[model samples]
Target: MEIKLVPVRPEDKGTLINLYQLYEHDFSRFTNRDIDKNGRYEVNIDFYWEGDERWNPFYIEVSGTIAGFLVVLFENMDIDPDPTHVIYDFMILQKYRRTGIGRAAAIKAFKMYNADWAVTQMENNTPAISFWRNVIKSFKEDNFTERYRPERKKYIQELSTKT
Candidate 1:
């Protein structure tokens, strides 16, 4: 399975919507809330409008099909620091799980952006936690931090590495 990163275009709205719905459904399993409510599901659309100046989105293609997507948000501290990229969301279709597509996509994103990237996984998703653990292990240079928020019963794992 050859994976490639394709820049997200306006014409890809349908595919992005489909992926967003799938991501929302998957997220609901851990949050126990319908994220589609209040049209929050349109966040991706908004991100697209916001343009690549700050956030950039990519479609992960495998065997010519869009198997997943990833969004990178660029940030800088104060006015003198170099910019860093964060993986705001990454989702691979259930059928494609464990196929190495996700890892390839992540590596591609890291190389394409050539900056630090971070991902946060909720504590409830043990599978995701383990998945990220392995990712960090394989990368071996990223720093991982765990933070707990009692109000939301959410645990966040932040991982980052310099390119």
Candidate 2:
């Protein structure tokens, strides 16, 4: 289970888009997301291509296989104002679920930044909530805050590695 987070290149945008479809499909269960007439869900990976230093995209590879993807967002990046590295998107294929690959990738992503972190999950997504809680707790013990944001309808876990 050698997990590596490879920085996604501009030429790999298509791969990211394809992987995003899967991520969105899985997320649709909790968000009730609907696809357009084209039979494809609209996802915004545009920010990753905006040449911003804050938006990072990575391909989660396990033993040279593309297992999933992760996007880390730095605060002050146009889309979000939170003062922390945000876990914008993360997904592991069905075959890789519950196998620790995702947890490993997530922890790797967190270690890439030495600042605070914010991991959010749709309010109805219990599995995501559990996954993030376990990962953050194992990474930083009980030094994080978990709160629900009514306006956004999501549960956000905020933690700091600086202290």
Candidate 1 — which residues are off by over 4 angstroms?
A: 35-44, 76-81, 141-163
Q: For residues 49-115, what per-residue lDDT tens digits would candidate 2 score against the true structure?
A: 7777888899999999999999887878566554578998898999999999999999998887778
Q: Top TM-score: which candidate number?
A: 2
TM-score of each model, in listed order: 0.79, 0.92
> Candidate 2 overall Cα lDDT vs. reference?
0.89
| Predicted candidate 1 versus true structure: per-residue lDDT over 1-163, tens digit per residue | 7899888877877878878888887878886765555655444466565544666778899989989898887765335266767777889999899999888787777667545556666767888777766776576555666677777665565555554
Model 2 worst lDDT window (10 residues):
75-84
lDDT of each: 0.73, 0.89
The top-ranked prediction according to lDDT is 2
TM-score of model 2 (CA atoms): 0.92
Q: Residue 13's C-alpha lDDT in candidate 2?
A: 93
Candidate 1: give its CA RMSD in angstroms: 3.4
